[model samples]
Target: MSIRPTIETRKAVPTMEGAGVHLHRAFGFQDPSELDPFLLFDDFRNEVPEHYMRGFPWHPHRGIETITYVLNGTVEHGDSLGNTGTLGAGDVQWMTAGSGILHQEMPKGNAKGQMHGFQLWGNLPSAQKMTAPRYQDVQAKDIPEVIDDDGTVVRVIVGEFWGKTGPVDGIAADPQYLDISIPPGVKKTFRIDTYRRAFAYVFAGQGAFVDASAPSGVLLEKEVMGQEVNIRDMSGDRTLVRFGTGDEVTVQAGEEGVRFLLISGAPIEEPVAWHGPIVMNTQAELQQAMRDLRNGTFIKPAH
Candidate 1:
């Protein structure tokens, strides 16, 4: 109940990633303290196979967790530990970098070369930076989808929702990851943990997120009929909406309806030293991680 007044909204920046893949970067590499315990979010979406085929080559991650969610196409991934899998539409993979690891993800489009997905980077505390790398691959079929009487659907991926807990757990940030959709002209407000920082990313269609205490970007939608009046404050798809403190969030879907990912997590408030895929507390720890990687012993011994 002690949540502060609404904070200013931070819009997603248009950026490219993954070998010429077009995407929007929500935030990264600057003022980590603003979003303590959580580092970055990227919305990678494309309709041309040639744009995404290059994919993400083998890369290293050490002190962070990466969550990948596929919306339309298929993403085949492999890690240094020999784990391999494919994530189809709606599937999620939460990978903990822990000590260190090498991973690659290749994207293949749907029938029309339509591919859409997102990746979020969650930071790990210093104590858990080397606590054994692991993964929770949540398949699309296994994710719990709850339908409200009003035609709203929600898919819980990382935390609890309406008394149901997500399959992925034991995370340092105790995050709540939800994919939600509201039917045309429906207004819905769902409860979120007031203690955690929360944000939403609009992926499909358009909507207005509102609340009396909501930030300025909280828009008012007025259209002639069956048309989406692109609110001047928000971009089209791949727009990231960061919310202010509130137990409940209200959203009104436009004529085309709206689909978005709503996520929240408790702030660690701990020091963060980040470089590339690795994050640690002290510079010395980061140096050690790099040295270990160079020495070919970054992964901890199997117990």
Candidate 2:
């Protein structure tokens, strides 16, 4: 089996969004073709109420789908389409801003004043860019979880894995999103479609993703005299790993085990004209969308 090699590894950068909420941006607002079909990923994890309570005020989105997975705390959301809901810990909300829509998300921390969650923006293909807006509110209990014999747990968020399919469907990208946790010091390999673009985001503990022979990026946490004694340590909190072509990926957990999100999707490979939350095909279309927003005609009847 061909093991996917790590092409790039970088740490998430701190950024402010959603009415002054402090968060980390893993990737976004750059070359859309790099990740293709997928546009942005933001990790909104904070322990301070003032940092996140302001939350994402009313905003507009079009020509994209937003997937939000909450690890802790609650996110109260409302949209212009008269949809309102609360997403608690472990809940997920996938919103398709087809055509156009205005929405707002307010975050409330748990008793300990801790909030954690992630939002991923996936681009819609040119064909479905003007489709009807929809929402898939998946409860934590509804998401399927598989526990392997080696104590590896995988939470399938989208697509199929281990004979189980995710609850959210009818997506344009046909992506596979998996939340995985490996046992400490245990090595595990996951098979992915060779044609899909894949990436991993590490949120807890540490781990290394590498191939058997080449050793692209492995874990090396130990340090000697402030110098890293192990250059193999490739993963830690808020780390993003982009993989090269291969059919499978191998990861080794560190002492505290490793928890991360593995995601892959077919590349859209289309010309992208992105302006803030609106992603279209050309500059004129983007300008038209902005003009519609100002004219109160951005959102059209569901088609």
Candidate 3:
């Protein structure tokens, strides 16, 4: 029952991607090993249609998987493989860009001109990097939501939790993705696999992550259940919290309650050679991928 300590906390940086679409990047283009098997995460939430209408134009990706979860509005997507679909609110699309593929995602805001969603890039192991590309498109209704006795709600998007299993499966990283909401002033603890690298992205309201084992400098005293506990600062919107090795994570919601995404995956622990959307194990592989794109052969023939 060890509690995971908060190792680092930082706010997501505002960034523009995919033809001037505004978004916030929590982590990417840095030390890939820091959150092994997970390369990038972006919160593409926008209230202005002009900011996101351009969306992600046709792009090539390989050696990785892209998971797009939509909370509001809709996303229309098409791929070079001749597949087309529209993802509405609460829909999730998990695309495995094994070998290679070209795709385009165009977003359309909801009636109120609001669009919010997240995109997470997961790395594939070397053995599966050249596997056939596939897609797992799960609708919101298919995703299981569990409510605890204390009114804590958890939407299990991937992996098994609370006597339920997520719809998306056969993933390389074996990750667990959870969308959780805690009521105001409520405290909750979640169990995570100690062997996996885990992180939480706070996107709504505020909360303090309790870490009894945290160092002195970042520790703040707070009263929990009549006992004094050390916790980090109240994490608000777009905050990223990385946890140290442990099996449990405790968070106390603020007055407005808190909603966050808790994601964890088994570490790949392999050398990464990445450039733009393509991620490979070595520079030579990346170079070959670029050459393939130039030669109009990036998309392999389906078997």
Q: List the residue pairs that clash in candidate 1.
A: none
Please give each candidate's TM-score.
0.90, 0.94, 0.96
Per-residue lDDT for 1-303 in model 1, tens only? 333333445557877665777777888888887766679988888887888899988888998999999999999999999999999998999999887889899999999899988899999887888888999998888988899998999998989997777888899999999999888877778788888888778888877664434444555656614544435433236677766676877776777788988888999888888887788999999899899889988877656
Question: Considering every candidate listed, which one attains the maximal TM-score?
Answer: 3
Which tens-of-lDDT digit does each residue in 1-303 have in candidate 3? 899888888899999999889999999999999999899999999999999999999999999999999999999999999999999999999999999999999999999999999999999999999999999999999999999999999999999999989999999999999999999878889999999999999999988887544545756676644545455567899999989899989998877789999999999999999999999999999999999999999999999
The model with the greater lDDT, 1 or 3, is 3
Task: Give the winner by lDDT.
Answer: 3
Task: Please state the error at residue 290 of candidate 3 in Å.
Answer: 0.6
Count backbone overlaps in model 2. 5
Instruction: Report the C-alpha lDDT of model 2 over 118-144, residue by residue, as the tens digit.
Output: 999999988988888999999999999
RMSD (Cα, Å) of model 1: 3.0
Order of quality (TM-score): 3, 2, 1
Per model, state how many residue pairs clash.
Answer: 0, 5, 0
Clashing pairs in 2: 218-232, 218-233, 219-232, 219-233, 220-233
Ten residues in sequence with the least summed lDDT for candidate 3: 224-233
